[model samples]
Target: MKHEDMVKSLSERVPLLKKEWLGIYRRMGEHPHAPKWNTLCGDRLFEADLESVRSFEGKLQKERLNFRELPPESIILWCSEMERRSQWFESVLNGIDIKNDWCRITPMTRRDMQSKLEQIVPLDADLSRLVVNPTSGTTGHPIPAPNHPAAVGCYDPLIQYALRMNGLNTDCSGDKVAAIQICSQQKTIVYHTVHSYLEGAGFAKINLEQNCWRTDESSAFYINDMHPVFLSGDPYSFLDYINRGIEYRPESILSTAISMEKIVRDKLHGYFRCPVVDMYSLNETGPIAYSCPHDPSKFHILPNDIFVEVLSGTGEPVPEGERGEIAVTGGRNPYLPLLRYLTGDTASMNYGECSCGEISPAIVNLGGRKLVLFYGKSGKIVNSIDISGIIRSFPVYTFSFIQRSDYRCTLKIAAGGELTSRSAKFMKEKIESLFDNEIKVEIESENILLKEKTMPFICELEL
Candidate 1:
């Protein structure tokens, strides 16, 4: 059947399609490798709504092509069109009976969503059909969030946007993706699944810990044989891959979940000779932005799926190029729609045209949550990124830090091989210097269970 005809048929059978997808998800959730398998299905389903996805893709393509040609008046009309499509925002505006006054509605924070998920969801939404997704709690405490199959399906187009921005062909037939990360104890350590969008395409998720794979060499052989188009993983998992000398070069590398430092990115590029795309996303908001092909520092927002705003401390819009809390509105997630949700992260906005020709608003100097900051002596705020960077430089298997008090910290580190005194002393000195030598840093060599939902930084200090 032709693509347009297929889309039309699928649209007519929306109810049946939803039922089939739900059944597939339920069956996969019961599998031994449930987590990985479900992820693969969710990603492929993003393309399940062929007509909607095509429309979205065309809109993004048009925005990029006409970015330079768009006059000031045309840009304003384009933005208004985007706002009109935000169903969640429209519902809220109607509920409050506020017309032509979007700013009148108060902005929401993560905590607000956590406490009142039902209120945030559309009133007419079918709750029974939505899936429950829990946040990873990397920034703050973990929270249960609602998700619809259509929302999960939106990932298909967002990922395509990222791939296109990175200069990869969107027609990925026979391509494969490998995701390396920790998995739940209930799931199989290594498993593979097929993509729904492309025939013969495959997806695999493997845990690289000692318990999962016997040796790095064995894992390397398995990965090379699969020969995935791109390898995706968190920073720590990617670091493990590099240290273990797993020398299989893929077409590209995607680093998500956490930020990637320049040194690590450069090293990965040196070894793989492929584009290292840093993806900025949240579990609640799916894919928000991705690194520009021409410059990794600038993140081009996914305008079709998300609307981003940089707001000051008082909840007012900040000037371009100024740092402020990131506020997101109009996501594809129908079950958990958000409006002006404060993301707890700080970034500066850039309106200048990107070298890659993507006219979408860009976010520069992206930093993690403010909650990750630790209090030090003399009112010094120590960033968790700095602490993690210093420790990641060592040959550790896994690590976590617990702040017992304002001036005391306990470090639990699992050694990959040997934790020598020289390396130990250097770590202590570096940490102590960051806290002005007033904070006591105690390092302990013990095996820390690196769970799927593990948070690197934990603060037990009472405020």
Candidate 2:
């Protein structure tokens, strides 16, 4: 069965998938090489718009394969071709001018974009293949998303493919494992192998807000039967484990959907005894970028599907090697197509060849969603993970810092394991020094933060 059919059947049973899936799967079978279209990307990979996605059958024709059941070789072949196309896509996308084909492209300013997003999408009616979507990160609350559904569809497989390329397969048969998810209280997002609707693969889920930072004999009792392949969580949640120190370290560890600083990533990487994989994506746009183990500083874009541009604040393109706002477009998702969508993310435009030999445009030092508040002193906006990193260095079970004012900030640490007042003091001093001015630090030790009140390390700007 094709992905669309599978989605339709499941949607009848579970209506939630209907609102989540953007109809990009119907067009996925258009081409010769395609994987099963399950859903969309949240904080996973960059899902670029596919050209032939406007019509349901057209999108399927582009991918010519039923993605419901993917073969190992097909994924392998797709990865090999992805490496080849990355370079080719980089060359073509770099030269695109807004003057040429407005139907193929369009640009929107950040201020007007946040206010008038839905009205801007109908700019090209013929371009119905491109759908609309939204993206929110750290402090940049939620940007208006008008994109192609084909782009969103592209994200699901690209993410799974990236995970498989990283030596972890989502389709782990017979082998039982567990995953730690921070997305929801239930951790029900089943993108990975064990995060399934059917069987959990012997998984044990703990909400990051619940302050289950450390693993002990009791916690281990839940996962002792099956040796888990990996533990996945946001960098903040991972630090909760790193702070108290995880009792049992899995073979592999994955962190995504939120920003992680070098210092924090290093600490988590050491604590887990594994490499931390960073994924760059948006809720509206889908997963557009992921960190390759071969290259940690840069994340490879899911090419042909995702077309990216680094633009200046004034809406003009920036020079390579200069810092600019990252903009993205194009994918297989028919429900939305973000054209010249201004991603609040700031990154340096890189055009040089990478050591990995992949040709697509790769972004380095992705400063997420303008969470870094640039105080007027030297215009240094603090990234979300930067604060998270400071608290992580201490022995706090779980922590979330709130930006109260320019110089004032509050730290709320949930107590778990053996965390005490001494650990909270250590955390305060570490993060207070980060700001040069008078910093008001408040530490609220909660036994457990409620589910609805779960504050991710970052929240988008509120309009």
Best by lDDT: 1
Q: Please, what are the lDDT tens digits per residue for candidate 1 over residues 28-107?
A: 22334233232232332444455565566677667542221112333344334433554545545554423334445567
lDDT of each: 0.62, 0.48
Estimate TM-scores for all models: 0.66, 0.52
What is the clash tally of candidate 1? 1
- Which lDDT tens digits does candidate 2 get at residues 245-266? 4367775666666677778778
Indicate the worst ten consecutive residues by lDDT in candidate 1.
65-74
Query: In model 1, what lDDT does residue 26 have?
Result: 32
lDDT of 2 at 151: 46
> Best-fitting candidate, measured by TM-score?
1
Backbone-clash count (model 2): 77
Residue ranges of candidate 1 with Cα displaced over 4 Å: 1-51, 63-100, 175-190, 214-216, 369-463
